[model samples]
Target: MALLLQLFFAHKVTALSILADMYKKRLIEDKEVVIASIVGMFPMGVRVVVLLLAPVAISVLGLKLGIIYVLLEVLSKFMVALIGVFLDRKYLAGGVLEYITNVSLKNSMLDAFKQFFKVLSILVPSIFLAMLLIDLSFNSLVSQISIETAHLLIVVTGTTSTIAGLGVAGSLIATNEVDGKSALLLLMIASALHRIVESLRFSMPVNISLFGSFGVRLTLILLLMNELASIFAILGLFLIINFGFV
Candidate 1:
């Protein structure tokens, strides 16, 4: 049963990848609708299937292989989610053109879906990579390191991702035809707004839901190259944990 389940999930991953690659370059009549369906269906499907089979695989493969498999699964989904978000947002929100014309950042319904994909893309892979790298470093310097090392790695990865994201945001705004300074100012304002929303979540129920929804929605779209960094992180972590730096 365990073997069968693993095989099933592996096959599902393959099929989903094929579909994503197929639609990668194609433009559809309804970009948002198609992108939403793809985003909603693919990662969730992979997540559910993997979660179900993971325990069984873990028992069979031991901690090392088990973690590796999970890392790969998380990273792959993250990449797909990132790409899906961009594709969806571009289609639904009309990309840079609409954003500048409207001067409003509130994403539409379809945009929400894209956002979720973008956040997930970043969160899943980042978390996995952090886990992997800490494990590796710990093993390499097994005598010198402590358990706190793992937690420290998490902090580092999160901070790095945030800083990198800010850089990307600034670059995007600067490149816009609108006044570069103005674009940067608008983006900074938006970031401040998002921060307020994040803070208010603790005391305000409505704001909590709003930011939570926003966070989830935003995951649907992230830069493609960031996804690769996440993959490397996961691989590095797994190597450290599994092999030890002997």
Candidate 2:
């Protein structure tokens, strides 16, 4: 396993290096390209870790439910990636620049946004996958989660990821000339405030049926059914291999 992991990491590093060169050739113009490259690899590392722990994550769903969870995980990641791409184009490049400039954000803030999007393209999927598992753990109807809380989670998680991504990007942008601690502190503060806001939102919908109770329960059933189908798919894959049908 260790050797396999090392080999997997080696490929990731090689890929990162290749991507760095590609950026250097096309987009990256600063001296901080190397730092950007290193930080850029963080999401790759995160994905690898998640895959390695797939068994544990699956355990929560049971073998049957687990397989379904994996598919949902994949679907969620795909959805997030699609959204990230749109975000990257619409906001990361243009909006981020405008937002930073108007707010008088320091240089690191600018660099961070560039880096954050690069990583977010990868991180969003992981987040999406994690959320499905979270739903499974909670087992409540999707509607049971208040709209305020739901929106809050989306905002908090999105903002926090954005800040962290930007910090890494900024560190690379500065090539260590800027203090890492200071940049990190700023990121933390931004994310912390977002969290506080989310907590406040969590309490705003008491005694209010955010969605109809019937719709909420129906959505849960559909989700459960989808999960079961995934388990059968995994079983079919295993059976195919056992029968040498491939």
**Top-lDDT structure, candidate number:** 1
**Candidate 1 error regions (>4 Å):** 1-29, 49-51, 94-246
Q: What TM-score does structure 2 among the candidates reach?
A: 0.24
What lDDT would each prediction earn against the true structure?
0.39, 0.36
- Lowest-sum lDDT 10-residue window in model 2: 95-104
Alpha-carbon runs more than 4 Å astray in model 2: 1-12, 26-51, 59-61, 84-246
lDDT of 2 by residue, 1-246 (tens): 122223224443333334334444554333222233223223333443254323432432234433433343344334333433454445333311111111223643454455546655645454454355345643344446653323333334435553233323232223432233333333333333543443334312210132224324423332333334334434544554466533
User: Largest TM-score belongs to which candidate?
Assistant: 1
lDDT, candidate 2, residue 188? 34
Question: Per-residue lDDT of 37-110 in model 1, one digit per residue for the tens?
Answer: 34543345364424432543243234444455445445555565566677765756452211111112243334
